[model samples]
Target: MKKFDKERLLLAVAGPVIALVAAMVLTSVVLVASGKSPVEPYSLMFQQATYSDVQVLIINEAGMYYLAALAVAVGFRMNLFNIGVDGQYRLAAMVTAVVGAHMSLPAGLQIPLLIVVAMLTGAFWAGIAGVLKTTRGVSEVVSTIMLNAIATSVIAYLTLDDKFGVPVGNNNTTGVMHESGWFPGIDMGDSGEIYGFVVVAALAGVLYWLILNRTRFGFDLRATGASQSAAAASGVNAKRMMLTAMLVSGAVAGLAGMPILLGDVHTYSLSFPTGLGFTGIGIALLGRNSPVGIALASLLWAFLVKASQALDYEGYDKEIAVIMQGLIVIAVVVSYEGVRRWGLRRQQQRVGEELAAAARAAGDENNGNNDSVKEVAAR
Candidate 1:
């Protein structure tokens, strides 16, 4: 249709498609080098992932990944890389677990309180980086990476034997939360109960889209991302938007763990999931930071995760999935750049063609006028 629409297609559709293709090709090569048939392993992965239990697991895991992707997307839209989401989420979950364990609030109130505590804890942790970036000119990337290390130490200190830690077998945990704080899930019969928090994650996605695509603050966030100086010239207060974006991202990151905390584990323990924040970065990139895109990306990620385990049982290395994931992440970056350059080239070609057509039309008009003038001179 329009040139702008064409360029957007390259971004929203073409990039992911190209990335998937490239990742698959590279993964196949890896399998071939290992003296294995690439097709068989993939076929097995897909077939095994079709089982009912695995499907349930994929959906449940996708819920968590979707939340994390949304969190990363928030910062992504503002050109902020909040690498400390790992720390932010861990600290938030730990602190929220402690609160949920100790508090004895009424029904509904306890869950809300714990969720609030999580969001606030995540925000506070991320805010330290925000404050450093805006006030002291420290790079968020450096500060956030450092924050993750600091968060681990802080969690360790808080969970010390003589402190809030409750020894559960070989590991320490922030004792199980009261039943009042537990979120209910939908029963899937033999498959398993799908995390109730999945519904919340979906709602969060909708809210994210609305905020980014339908609000002025979103416009400011995007503007700042595109060009901080330009946004500043337009009176958008770029620094404030940057800080706000980081805090919002952290707030969302806190929710990434709730599906496990409230729906399954009901506590913060050494077994709590980690590296999810890093995973979210890849999902966000693969999804191109769109709400729908992120959802699909999370599903694909979860599918690979569930299917990869099946590989181990089949005498195949489960690390194949990890290699694919790594390649996909790398391909996403390359594909985006490639598509962007292609779009630019296409746009230039279109402009050149239009200008050439206009020039030809002008030449025809001039020739016709000249002929008419010669006729008059002849007469």
Candidate 2:
């Protein structure tokens, strides 16, 4: 059992490492094919990533990615694809920004209240898809894609009027949140300010780990994901688990935009960052839906995003960065599956050897028992 566990751990760790190496090699080939020096791009990327200001930016960006990926991972563990995280976070952020703008409470109360409202709004929006899935057999993918459009339209309509938005220069946006509602930034000497909600993202990762690995509900969720029919036979309520997963996913998605909204922009505007939720899907896949893996993947993804900016100055197409990211995700998913199959084969071989050895020992004991009985009878 100990050996088996060690092998499992080794495989888990090695899978990602192998995947990354494979991805780098493939990306280099692509770069060479395009007549670019792979070494130059990678060197530039790493050099820029090492700068203090760039490091802070990477962390801040990674924080948001981490939260977004966590949101997607929750649904993934339950076999759900929550593509609506984009819509959920955007709508939640807009509503929270609007609410925060109207309130003038102390920072302690206002921030939490804003966050709660965001979570509730996101939950409600995602719950619609879950409810439809359970009650009307609607596919979450189709429903979520439709929900994204609906969310965009809703935001468009709401922000066009003075009721939910105010004109700021040429753009429409929610009123700026009061200082009391803003999260303070962290100073890093010469590195300017890092978004304080990085801590929140860390806490979310810890909580996700605990809930998915250390709770009974998590067991039911994993079981259902493994085999819904088996989980049902074991008395797990598939519908209830699905609903809970979706709600939790959306609630986390609510936080995906909070760091940028509360820590920097302090408003939800037409210029707010979008499509991060979709990016989360790729990050989650690259991480294999694990917390630690997701954090690392988020950082790597953020680094690439930051590093890509330097390409414009270096006379290289920035689109190559996107291609690398896409290739990494695809390569990682395939490599992980390959590693899983290899691990399964090794485990099966070990089990077979153990069973064979046990059978031989049993046969020897039976022969010894017969010889003893015959000797006793002769005496």
Candidate 3:
């Protein structure tokens, strides 16, 4: 095949293969140091995860992770690190839940409305960071991190008191949303219910792929990420691209909490989940920010989490999974860098060889002409 195609194929195969190998080696070392055999723990984890109920749980968790990762992936593509996704989703979910709780619209309308509310709120929160970066020369990473702290305080204030909070027995929460706003869960035979919102998460992935691979906006975003100066020279508005990418990322992050909110909890409680946004960052890096890659990475992460739950029963530490995950992330980063270096070396070698061949061909042609001229002179 062509050199570029071959290089692409090699990178695709090499990165994950090398990363997995390195992770396994490191994890094995850890296990040995802990006085445990790596084989038995892994086998037990996998076997337990194979159970029907656990499989559903894995998918359910993956659905949420899928959305979060996609959100992070969007910002990553634009060279924007939107660390505020944690806050964006929490605030979005809180506002959407409160609004949804009060609305009595039909299911068809209410569900979409709540989703739109999520997107809008998430975009608005993220937009703050985008605006700061574009207009004030603020670093997005710093702005977003600060925004997350603010969002947490805001969510706490709104959800903790009677002003927006509803009393449910002894708990304070955004009152339960009506059935109309709930996404029905899908029942798997002998397994627990899977979140129906998984379909939405899947659709989000499709949209992400389409936008990144098929749209001018995506092209601009990627171009900007590759090199802001080059993109600016090409007349692409780098600031605008960054802002738009950040907004879109936040909008997508709004969906991150929906699986739990609509499928299971049906309310925004004090215990509403957090940290998935941070997890998304790791997953995005692991997946290399590709939509398909992120999906697989999400599943793998979910499996590790779900399977590890049984470790406690087996007298093994559940934190082992966390350790393994950390190792995998580190290894994957090293592997990608190595692959990049190897590719650069190969490309240089190829260019050098081509140049040498061309020089030899030119020398041969020039020598032949000189010999022909000499023969004519001698004759």
Candidate 4:
């Protein structure tokens, strides 16, 4: 490959490596301070990964994480922070579950209907923040934050026994979906079943890459992210792009929790998964907003989670994984900035050298012309 391309790739790889090494080193120190062996936890985690069931669990979880990260990355692309992903996801899942529970349609039709319902629900929820941002000039961060709280209250109200929720021992839930509404998964016998939505997530990643890298709307979105003034000067509708981005982001987020509900849990209960959206921000940042990078990040995160389960039995705090994850994201942010500055410096130096060479060549050419002119005059 070209030298410049190689350098870019090297820098790209270097950021993640630097972050990982820094995080590991700090985690080791923390483990030592706690009078625990860091190596032991890692070793046990690796051994646990050898089990097929654990591997299956990791894949299923990774798929869910991939979708959440994608949703967050969409906003990241537009320089918008949709912190309300958790709310959008939960509210969508809850409503989808309720709607699906009430239906008795066939799998082919029912599955798509539930999914569409989920996406629309999330879009409408997130669209509120988008509309407020475009019309009221409210910051997306502030608006999304408020929306998350409002979503929480709305969910709480919906889950009341007097509403659509059913009592389940200690927790209230949207009643389970019928068999026809369930998304069929890949059964791994005794090992476990892989969520079918994982395949859908993979497709989503492909679409994300294609749309962002290969379309006019993506160009407008990214250009606006880089500089709204430049994009607006170019005739791109910045407000429209912002609203569209939010709608797209929340729609993907709506799918984030569907795997767990449709493929495994079959209901939206108080025990249903939460915080996946928050975790996605870290993954999206770590991955640098690349679809493939995000997939790898999600897998790595899922691995850490699966490994943390055994840390408690090893006399280590399972929260170590959480600590490590936090450290990784922080380190990545710092390292990426450092690499970016270094790259910028290198590029400037390269440009300076090229300009100097061009100047020297021009000077030589001018001297030769002058010498020829003098010789011709003498002749």
Candidate 5:
């Protein structure tokens, strides 16, 4: 394979493998410290993984998680840390639920409309931060973080009031969406199985990949991401790119919440978000900010979550999963940076070698020409 391809392959494999090894070592140390065998908990987790229902649950949850991770990954590529994805997602879900609950459109129109409105809501919410950063000279990091708090407050207010409140008492939640807005599940028959949101997740992964790899817009976004000053100098419009990237990221995140709102809960509630946006950062890092990588990372996370839930039946603490996740994230972060630096060093060395070789070739050609001149003079 070409050097570039090899470098990509190395990057693709290094982080997750290193993370797995590190997580294993950490789990072993934890078990030893706790005076328990690591083997038992892992064995139980493995056992749970074999169940059909558990597998379905993992796939479903992973699909949702993948959407969130993709959203975060987009911002990461632009060197923008979008910490307010949770709020963007929540606001979108709220808007979707409210629209779905009140709209009298047919099923075909209502579902699509709800999805579009949700995406727009998320985009608008994120645009606020972008505008603040571009127009007011605020740091996107600070603005996004503050926006998350603001979104939470707004959602709380909307869901707590009787006119806007869901029937779920004083809790902050919107009323259930109408049947027209619900996503349809596929029946697998006999096996008591249903294909859930995995299809949406797969499509999302493809969409993200295409957007990044094939589009002119994506090229401009990546250019700005790599170097905002350079991009601006080249007439790429850096501020607009940043704002567009954030809006697109928010839209993706908004779609991420739809699985929970339309499929799992059938409504928007205070509990709708459930920290998936925060978890997405870990997933994005673990996946190395690639679409396929993020999808696989999400699947791995979903597996751990499902395995953790089974701990209740096996008489083990569910917190073990969280600890394992933390360990994995740390491992991936360290390894990714290490590998990236190593790759850069290697590239620099190769470039230096190529330049030296060219210089030597030029010197040899000059020497040969000198010899020819000397011989001709002697003749």
Candidate 6:
């Protein structure tokens, strides 16, 4: 049994590594077909990776991305699909920006209030889909997708109108938010763009881990995810769990938008909240839904994005960077699924063996009892 467990563990660890190598090989083939030297680009990427500022940038960016991915993972844990994170995040940021722009509150009150409001806005947005799924029996996937379109349209309409719009001269953007609402950066001299939000993200991760691993609510969620019928039989409320998961997912996603809205831009704008939600799906998969793993994966992704931006200076194709992102996600998913299937098969085999052994023991006991009866009857 020890050996079998060890073998399974090894396979679980090795599978992703093998898949990454395979992905690299496949990418190399594409590079060759394009008449580009894969070796040069890869070497350049490594060279850029070694800089200290670049390292810090990766860390900062990764922390934000990981937070967003964690939101998606929370839904995944409950077997609830929440593709509406994109919409939730956008609406939250927009609300926060608008509030910050108009409010005259002090820095201490304003910042926390914005963060709280953002979280509530996101949760409320996601709750709409949750309500539809529970009350109307609507599929969350369909509802969330439609919600995204609705959210986008709403933002567009609000931003275009003179009464509420940001003065972007007919463009969809909000006015600059007040300085009091901005999140301050942790200033390490000569370090670029590092914010206090990294610490917030770490705290968020710790809180998430606690919520998922130490709470009864989390147990119910996992139970429902494993099997809805079994969860129901065990007195778990699967529908409530789904609703809770989506709400939590949206709150986390809203928090994730803070770095961009409060740190970098200090305002909401059209296309400003772009792609992070979708990118989070890839980050979550790469992280394997584990907090530490997700943090590491986010950093790797950040590095790739930063490196890709550097390509413009070297006259290299920026599209290659996007390709790498897609490839990594594909590789991670394929690897995780393969390893999961292998583990399940092993578990099933173990269960079968245990059942067979129990049957044999029962049969032997019955035979022994029969023999004793026969001897007594003969006497």
TM-score list, all predictions:
0.95, 0.96, 0.95, 0.98, 0.93, 0.89
Compared with the true structure, the alpha-carbon lDDT of candidate 4 equals 0.93
Write down the worst ten-residue block by lDDT for model 3.
160-169
Candidate 5 displacement at residue 302 in angstroms = 0.6
What is the C-alpha lDDT profile of model 5 across 326-348, one tens digit per residue?
A: 99989988888888898889889
Residue-level error in angstroms, candidate 5, position 165: 1.1
Report the C-alpha lDDT of model 3 over 1-379, residue by residue, as the tens digit. 9978988888877887788788878888889998999788889888988799988989999999999999999999998898888999999999999998888799999999999999999999999999999999999999999999999889878876667888777778998899999998898877879999999999999989998899988899999999999999999999999889989999999999999999999999878889989989888888889888888889989999999999999899988889888888888889999999998999899899999999999999999999999999999
Candidate 5, which segments miss by more than 4 Å at Cα?
Answer: 169-172, 189-196
Q: Write the per-residue lDDT of candidate 4 for residues 81-103, one digit (tens) a residue.
A: 99989999999999999998899
lDDT of 6 by residue, 24-98 (tens): 777777888999877777777778888878877777778779878988999899888788888888888888888
lDDT (CA) for every model shown?
A: 0.92, 0.91, 0.91, 0.93, 0.84, 0.83
lDDT top scorer: 4
Task: Give me the overall lDDT of model 3.
Answer: 0.91
Over the stretch 1-379, how does candidate 2's per-residue lDDT look in tens digits? Answer: 6987999788878777887787788888888998989888888889999899999999999999999999999999999999999999999999999898888899999989998999999999999999999889899999999999999999998888657879988999988888999998898888888999999999999989998889999899999999999999999999988898899999999999999999999999999999989999989988889999999999999998988899889978777778878888787788888988998899899999999999999999999999999999999
Report residue 376 deviation for candidate 3 (angstroms): 5.2
What value does the lDDT take at residue 234 in candidate 2?
98
Q: Is candidate 4 or candidate 5 better by lDDT?
A: 4
- Stretches of candidate 2 exceeding 4 Å from the true structure: 377-379
Candidate 1 residues 250-337, lDDT tens each?
Answer: 9999989999998999989899999889999999999999999999999999998888897878878989999999999999999999
Any runs in candidate 3 off by more than 4 Å, and if so which?
1-3, 371-379
Clash count for each candidate, listed in order shown: 0, 0, 0, 0, 0, 0
> Which pairs clash in model 2?
none
Off by over 4 Å in 1: 1-7, 361-379
Residue 138 miss distance in model 3 (angstroms):
1.3
